[model samples]
Target: MNLSICVLPMHEHLIKVAVVGHPSEGKSSVIATLAERDDIRISARSPETRECHSYDIQVGNQTLLELIDTPGFQRPREACAEFKLYEERIGTDNIAATFLAEHGQDPRFDAERKILTPLAEGAGLIYVVDASRPISKDDRHEVEILRLTGRPRLAVINAKADESTHMDAWYALLNSTFNLVRPFNAHRASFAERMDLLRALGQLEKSWQTDIDAIIAAFQVDWQARMDECAEAILDCIEAIVLLRVAKTCNADDRREKERVAQQVADSYREKCAKRERECHQAIRRAFKHQLFDPAPVTELQHGLLDEETWRLLGLNSRQLRRALMMTGAALGLTADVALAGVSLGVGTGTGAAAGYLMGRYAMQPLSMLRAHTRKDSWLSRSMRREIYLGPARNLQIVFVLLDRALGCAHLARNWTHARRDHESIMVTRPTAATKEWSQVDRDAISRYHVAILKGSSEQVYERRTAVRELLVKLLAS
Candidate 1:
């Protein structure tokens, strides 16, 4: 047998950036946010990274960039003194290489050596500093050491505090030393801010401009794809709720037993709908690369999806609903015919116009008897017993409510950055009345989709569902 070996080609000119800073200055957090890597060990109690670790910013098969998380400088002043001594002996050409050569095995300069090792290997530098605190001599020393390395560097102000009073001083110091300085909130940086930082990185080296542009383009395309996925998940959740039905067989003559069965079906329906909604949110989280962080429902919106407050806050108001009904060709004066599985509901104008307002104002009765079908006893000669259906909800307000909640949750998940490690949940923004802002075109499209779902036409449902998805993608992008 012949032995065959193959070597995979490495990405030529892969941008390597070493993130260096003092302990607890958010070097790891910056990398986590920029790279969207949740596996990076980050803690508030103490510094988590004790050595240099390289993480690739991979887009599919290509590694566009590499972020090197390095240990914080333990003794920058001492390291700066060593640099001066080396510059005098080795003449400033390869200060990083010469210093690492001498201090590579030294126990006292272990962190310094690891932090500077990447610079020795020609990696660009990203020096992180907390702009919230006052500048010190040690910071100056650290900057001096990086400057002597002769590598293109960018200064990042990682302001962890709420009120940063010394931002001016930090910028003044960084401006004189680093090629470019940018303030990045690792825990709160949005996708746009991250992109801005990448553009700043491109400015560091003229040769790296094309590569940086390509990476940014890839990221933009990936973000749009994720948004599209999120839209599909949200629409799927709403569709499941719209098409949901739960039934129970109860003796039609026994009113008490019938009521009990109805209540059970309603509860079950609520839970199923809520579960679908949660699964949608989880899908959105995955789209944003939040595999480890499961955001809890902390706001008022988390109070059960069928809660009275939820309905009131999220569902369309009475006026909006009335207009939407009219737009869908619902006759105002005559007994209004709202489609419910070919079951025509004779809702009067007062009922139709006030439906949304009443639903929002009072508690929502999630399930109602669609119809009772009688079945004859085959084994024994017995009277007809009825099987009661509790759902495929008849109330049109639910469509708007589900739409609002799904859109609001998608917005929250979309904005939730990967760097946030806190247990606090993303607050569901209110008045989650998402449909109230819909253009006439949007409302008309949704109305058609609603009718298509109720009519149970596969072809019409597919066309209408596709239209809704396109609308949702635009909304999510906005």
Candidate 2:
């Protein structure tokens, strides 16, 4: 199912948090990454978020939370110094509110007013900071400013993954200022880690805990559904590839005439396989909620999909193919024996071994084209083109290649936060590991899948595909 169909829960009591921090501290980046909304304006330079913008996080097309991205605190120290004097006038609790009321249009306090307005209007404060940098006077002043507002506040330490020299210091200081503190890297975190942070936000205030609980639950359901759909998409591609075939009638034609027809059919079959695989990949991108685009003309996918280099690199060339065939054959034999109630175990084993040996003989040769010559076309017209059939893409190695590349893309797409606006291609660096995760021992789902692709009923294919899909989902999760 697509995300739009998932009936996720929603609560009327909204959880609104104002993302605030000093300029160039990744304040907008944090919000962008958390919301998984790339449309949010983000920049590393000062004053990126000039006007306050609120992003509504929807579940099942219903708004559950609102994240307000506001201008960074440019004058935190001066504002805090000035507001401190007003503590004696109307007490510290009303200082932020009073400061907003009086200086709403003051150009000098323009950024400060935009940031405090949400906190003044009951939105929780999500103070962001570059924890890699040492704590400064401005950081303390901003923390004090939010503390004086008497509102629920949380701190997110946005530090580089490799930069940890000052993380301990930030944790100690931020724990004193906010209800909860978490360390996060906007660029490299996984989907699970992002959800973990959102869950932490739910615990910041008791007033919104119930509603936030509902949001978290709904979000989890939505994510799980996406993973399931993605897995199904990958298997669906396999099913299509397995079922693809091109047939042509062949008369009592000469060898050259038959070879011409074979070449034509083989070429057409290759094109269809490539096209179908691309369509499946696009479907996967949509299922994962990524903006879908045909990235084939882009060499990464084009080359990796069927390149001979990839086959050799993945070790599916000679040795691995023989190994995979033997495992699949043994599993097939076991399945047949089970079907025969152990009465024909030898029959199953011998037939399966023969088939496996025949397949292994052409381990390094192309299997996309085959000859199934028969005298069935005796009544065919001599005028018609002497035809031969090709495909269902007989190459089993193609499956291994596509699976390896697809898994790599899935891994990257699921982990990539929408905030990233780059065009980095998902690369399949380790093809051997990708296709050989299954062992030869026993009739495991993968071994069964290999057997089914060769000769199994549609129902058998569906069942094995479903199991393989679940395993792929588990891989993504890990």
Candidate 3:
């Protein structure tokens, strides 16, 4: 089954903790105990987990905690052979196994060489020991192996219900050998006990707190960066659609031919845009998979095609959409008849922005010619006689008009301006340093967004964009 993974934006306040121990030591059970969730399967036998498993735990609406479970450590002799085999196959020695194989030859070091794999994955060791047996050299060796991982670790003394003696020796050895130590009954571990264990983990290393903080901060920064990129991609798609539309309306010699060409452009543009959207989605999802909240829903928007729901979802109200449509129609005029042809060409070329602009220009030519005639009545007959020359002129006028409108619409949408005020807002603020910065950011973000779209799905790209936008807004506000 395909797992639907939502990537969580990097936050400045999240923690990722891994639970690791030797086989048959209740590593999975500890996770179940800590999470208070029965989703993880537990077993009394060894080697239950063969690969890594990750779980996201929510501490609050905005706070997330991640836990990774790793494969059980193997016996020293078996581990060395596995290491040699793995090294030969992969063309590189496995780091964990190398450490174990080097140390496993000594008879006194067998237990110490066993718990290497779990240690290598940066899992702070939760060395589980059965308190039923007397303190032995083997347990001491295991502690030595965990220390080799060079991570902050905790020792969990699993006291079998019946035997509780020899606690002093265990405590003494732990104090001298391990980083932190605690007692946990896997079968009867309570929530309070789990919280205490986490608290101990928090204090295991003096620098762990800082590392967790850094990871969160990185997440937030990355998320904002991605959103800006997605917004730019959306604009690119719109621009292409507009350019194609203008081209179809102005350039086609015959009506049917014009319609056919436009349709081709539109289809090509749609496929390219769809591909881009997918890439953006996958990148964002991967980045934010560990977050607490689900990301904003992703919706695929087809270039130059507006369904009622899509229009509404663009954050435009019904009246605003109607106005935009009216403006588009007016701008399109007789050119609307050639829209299908233009769409086709746009889709074929996979260049929606250029096609849309071209179609928009084609539609605007007649209006420009009419206006020119009204202004120069003395030249009316001559202009009428020169109607044949109007094709190129009409095309140019359509191009300019469409370019202006498409860009204006993009700006208004990103700036969160309502449709009624969009025209007035255009060119209202003189381009400044802040505007330039925003523009650059938008450009960079869009380029990255396009890369992501090309790699994944529309929904995936949209989600990444949303996360990025949210992060940027938050950062700017701060």
Best by lDDT: 1
TM-score of each: 0.87, 0.83, 0.34
Whole-model lDDT, model 3: 0.44
Winner on lDDT between 1 and 2 is 1
Tens-place lDDT digits, model 1, residues 1-478? 0111122133456889999999889999999888888888888887889988998865555666789999999999999999999888777887999998888799999899998888999999999998988998999999999999989999999899976789888888889999999999998898899999999999999877877777777788788888789878877877787778776676767888877776676677767877887887788778877777654263224666666666667666666665565433332221233322223345444444444333322213332222322333243646445555545554556777777776776676666666678745444434357787788788878877776776647998899989999998988888
**Looking at candidate 1, what is the lDDT of residue 308?**
66
Question: How many backbone clashes can be found in candidate 2?
Answer: 0
lDDT of 2 by residue, 228-313 (tens): 87777777787787667776765435667676666676677768877877776676666566663223333245354545555555
Cα RMSD of predicted structure 1: 5.4
Rank ordering of all candidates by TM-score, starting from the highest: 1, 2, 3
lDDT of each: 0.74, 0.68, 0.44
Q: Is 1 or 3 the stronger prediction by TM-score?
A: 1
Winning model by TM-score: 1
In model 2, what lDDT does residue 390 have? 53
Better structure of 2 and 3 per lDDT: 2
